[model samples]
Target: MTHPHRTSDPGVRARFLLAATAWTVLVAAVLVAVPLTFAGRLPDPVASHWGPSGRPDRSMPAAALTLFALVWLVVAGTGLVGLARARGEIRRATRAWFAAGLGWIGGFLIGIQAVTIAANLDRDGWSRAASLSWQVAVVVVGAFVLGALGRLAGRLGPDDAPPERERPGPLIDLDPGRRPVWVSTATAPWAVGLGVVASAAALSFAAAALWGLAPAGWSTALPLALAGVVGLAVSSVSVRIAPEGLTMAFGPLRWPSRTVRLDRIERAWVEWRSPVQVGGWGIRGLPGRATIMIRGGECLVVRYTSGGQLAVSVDDAETGAALLNALAARKTA
Candidate 1:
């Protein structure tokens, strides 16, 4: 409830750590408990492959199964640790998502193991694996856990406050009185092209899965769903600078638009960068400060009150940055 503007409180930090620990412990416990409890009972080479019908199609030696479990443990553990240790980009919200994802994956795998054990209780040669219901249940449970933990993680810490001293005025050289309400907007052709390509690929994959050319199930659907989202995010982008702040949104759906309030902006400038500087391209970087590297050339950088910065690549970035700075200065003055 107490949302600090820039500082993080102890309670949130504690909860975050606790959630991360819970995820790791649960996974480790399941990984160890599954084999120890059912090692002698399970078939020497257990059914390991699942078909589109969600039935076991192939088998793996018990030793191979153990190796697989260890690999999963290592991968899941390393990711959680990295997310916890990394700063800036993996903030509270993102961290919670990572935790939830681990939780979901761990839960799903455990569920599969449980189902396998139950199915093999009286089996002879091959174990008849359970239906896909368990998988669906795992997904639902994971989603619920994610929402709950995300809410518990709280907002960005209030520690990153703005400086007391005001910054120097804009270097635009234009008289504030002479300039009318300035505006600049442009579409990212590269992003649009990328979106189209991704959409085409997604469609192809989905068709293959649906028509039985490939396995149809959660694995096949997840990537298709993500492709749709990426397509929407990149296909249509428009940037606007006004008295309220600088706004960026997809198409006309502006409710979720990313905006830096006029009061929060300290200064603005123009810069050029590549993936080497801002991590990667296409809506990349951290939460408070992100780099919208569409085509990657000139970018308008806005330094805000919370000591955070955001960069958006666009044509005539100098003009956009100058206008933003002028507007911010007038408001601050």
Candidate 2:
């Protein structure tokens, strides 16, 4: 029940590694033993039964649960290492790890089914070929997921502070060697867009698999289902600096859509842009003259001293707004 605390000190890391390895070995032993004990107490998991006589319908999910636990342990171990080494961006690494884990697990499951299809090519030709491809994609997804998770986990805390350091960043250590800094908020619109897509895909898959008994009529919903996954893939990463200005990217397909300079802002303000103002959900349209999201209910709206305004969703809008003001103030003062 206790959560693992990450530490990078050589002694601490060694203790953790030993304990984790021991724990993993213990869990694996249980998984192997329990399944073997009950091997055929249940029918083939793929077989679905409705009548009173057809082998009930419970054993497979339980087996799947055991399998999932096995995979999760492996993932958690890798994530632990990232936590140790990622001094500054633990949060980022964590997030990427989760994304990658999910991607990999999904790939693995789909790939398993694909392998079955491929095995019966003469019996299930198209399905078999598709399954083979799915398996490859899954393996690839699983392999890289840990790496991404590490990057995301490292970013979980304040900007650049080490995992062992006192609180994280907002104030950068003044070092001439480190140049312009870059950051971006996950933002509200981007979140809503992803949420909508993810929800749709999940619901579609569930509905088709559970309620749908017919293969022909249920075939067409796939395109729309896939589009949601694609939409969820889109994200906005903001990279800014004392010199780099502000550049926001929408997706892999598009370049930076908005830009704001550092010197132009004459004054700025911090406020929460109500979802009402952003036309309610998703980044499909620019809601208003100013906007941003994701922070703790706020955004930094900067008015260029010489030009237009830039609205950014940051963790602490007021703090970020003040920081920009301080920087600008120092420049002018």
Q: Could you say which candidate leads in lDDT?
A: 1
Candidate 1 wrong stretches, greater than 4 Å:
1-7, 10-15, 52-54, 67-71, 87-91, 127-282, 285-309, 312-333
> In terms of TM-score, how similar is model 2 to the real structure?
0.34
What lDDT score belongs to each candidate, Candidate 1 first? 0.63, 0.45
Residues 1-333, model 1: lDDT tens digits: 665454545555556666667766766777667776787777767776667787778887755544536766786776655444443333454544555556566665665566556655445656554444466576567656755654454343433343465444345644656643444544556556656676677777777788888775447557766775665575445678877888876632432577767898888877666543454456787787788765445777788889887888767777777778778767767
Candidate 1 CA-lDDT value? 0.63
Model 1: per-residue Cα lDDT at residue 54: 76
Q: Tens digit of lDDT per residue, candidate 2, span 26-121?
A: 545554554445444432342212224322232233245246446756765554454344332223333343444444543454344333323332
